[model samples]
Target: MTFFAEIFEGLRISWAAIRANRMRSVLTTLGVIIGVLTVTMMATAINGLNSTFQTSISIMGADVVYVQRFGWFMDRNEWLRSRNRREITMEQVRGVERQLTTAQAISPVAMTRKDLVYQRRNGGAVQIIGTTEKQVETGGLNMSQGRFFAAAEVEGARPVCVIGDDVATRMFPNESPLGRRLQVGDRTLEVVGVVEKRGRFLGMFSLDEVVFLPVTFFFNAYEQRPDLRIDVKVGSLAGIEETREELIGIMRKLRKTPPGAPDDFAINQQEAFVQNFNKVGGTIAALGLFVTGLSLFVGGIGIMNIMFVSVSERTKEIGIRRAIGAKRRTILLQFLIESVLLCVMGGIIALLLSAPITLVVALFLPAALSPSIILIALGVSITTGVISGFVPAYRASQMSPVDALRTE
Candidate 1:
């Protein structure tokens, strides 16, 4: 109770001091405000981006791997070597299904961009994917309406199609998209199913801006010899490493590669993407740390300098208080509370400024002022205040009453 009372009294005196020197207090708080703002916006942007990236990649299926012509992140030398490798044909995809023991599902995938049409409406430049019914397993797909086309339909070169949320909404607003004949590129395809909304990819490209069709029909409509991507889903995530090795051996055998030569095919997976993203994230974290440290150092020095000035200006006041039998702890608490109040004010102002900026970022990502970051900002402000104010407060507390009184 005694400690609380002292703190309350200190706060009352601190508020009075601030009110008496309003302009000085405001200018002193400016440095803290800039520092807090830098700390907050950097944390919030990274948090939002991290969250968005994780959600986007969740649907990439950790248990799945892609056998593609090239790696996603490749150097010039690797790209040159992989460029002339033989394309993965659909027959190889079928052969893998027959021979592989670890794979749960295997799909031969191909893609192209085309304009979509339904009645008078046009959805410009949408991604169209060609794959087998096994894509439902290889890709993380949840059908919101109707059903995926039958295996027989896929083998028979049927013109049935599955549309994503964006396509279903834009092309058939007032009616069910099922059984609706939609024109993709120049060929007409009936919409047999609609995919559930799966948000954007990396908070940039819309995953919903895609349509899936049977590879047989796709080849008929688009290119006769389109490059293929073989998607393989293992029975479990633990089995993926062995599954990749099996795929390499199968491809090498099919191509009849000479002994001791490097494998020509690339087996890409979600982990490769995650590894690359981590490197980029590390760079961003380093940069943010550097800027935050510099700002806090400059800001802390300004607070310390201003606090020393405050102690010098009030030497006579300190002398009078000491002569009247005020304790050293009370004097120290008074200065410390004053320093803390200024920083709290700056933190509040930075939060107000950050709200609109966070909202603007939310337009492009899943960003908001999470509760954790708010606590962090306020906690940083309080810590900075204590460190910056300690020396000035201790000097004021240790002042010799006679010397302080004689000065002014």
Candidate 2:
């Protein structure tokens, strides 16, 4: 017979065997079903997390660097040292901007959390950012209506502000926000622009629940010295490392650090955040895979045990087939095909179970099972079947025709 014909015949025989004991077939495949379900769910969650983080980081601007007093994550000793260092100032921002040859834009940022009110409407505990006109460039902000505060307005510390999309929807639900006055703390400021909807940051905090004002205006309204950071946007992604080194050198010179002294300020970037997130993500993925892999391993052992039982039960049938001139290779192929078909069925059932689970998870996170994951699950199941069934199939193939038929 042709190769295709042999495969077809094996599949037909395998299906007949499975149908002959439906309950047993289903019970035998339970291990594979559980295994595939665990693996697919884990992969879906990890992929979702990766997608969410990449989106969040992109919004923060990959080419932008934050020059701040402290790094995002640091050791206790480093934190203490950073705390003692002098706060970044607007003057230093200007100095860096003046000296930077590869920077596209630089802006100083100061932030506070304040309750925003518009007549009777109130936006509670909104993040208030104080920055200059160049913030639009450095932060990659896009306006939905009107425009960012002009350079003159920033220089004058004008009582003008740009609101985020959530702020606009909340404060000016019935009317256009442009030209309307809003109360930021005790100060009344005109809303000159409304930012486009820029979803959550880190999938935890809403980026749109914010207000941006001129840096000078913020310093004026809040009598206390506001905490400051400088944001620098580089000309190209390729030169980010170079620009970072230059920034460090400039900061050291500006801060008057003694030669060989450790730097006080932190030059933070999205890449640094990504690297840290990846380390944590990788660990989570590894742990998840290890646990789920155990499930698959257990399933393989179950398949192996079931195949052995199948071989024992089919010894008479094997002997009969051998006596009828069925080749040993054909007998091996038949059992192996039966094992593989069982696993493939289990994989399909697992995918059906996983779909609803993944949908429920997506309601909370960005989870979704992709096509590649489906294909991988199927492939894993098939491979597991082949490995688990090989010994049992070989044993069945080696049966002697006379010994197998004597009992029957």
Top-scoring candidate (lDDT): 2
Candidate 1 lDDT, tens digit per residue, 1-408? 978988998899888888898998888888888888888888887888788778877877788899987888999998887789888777777778788888999988999999998888887879999999998988889999999887998989899999999989988999999999999999999999999999888888888989999999888889887889999989688999999999999887876777799887789998998888889888987899799878877877788888899899898988888888778998898899888888888888888888898899788667779888889889888888888988999999999989887778
The whole-model lDDT of each prediction reads 0.87, 0.89
Q: Which stretches of candidate 1 lie over 4 Å from their true place?
A: 324-329
Error of 1 at 6 (Å): 2.7
Error of 1 at 380 (Å): 1.5
For each candidate, what TM-score against the reference?
A: 0.94, 0.95
lDDT of 1 at 176: 99
Q: Native-vs-model 1 lDDT?
A: 0.87
Question: Whole-model lDDT, candidate 2?
Answer: 0.89
Please give, for residues 8-68, the per-residue lDDT of candidate 2 as tens digits.
9889988998899899889889999999898899888888888889889888888999999
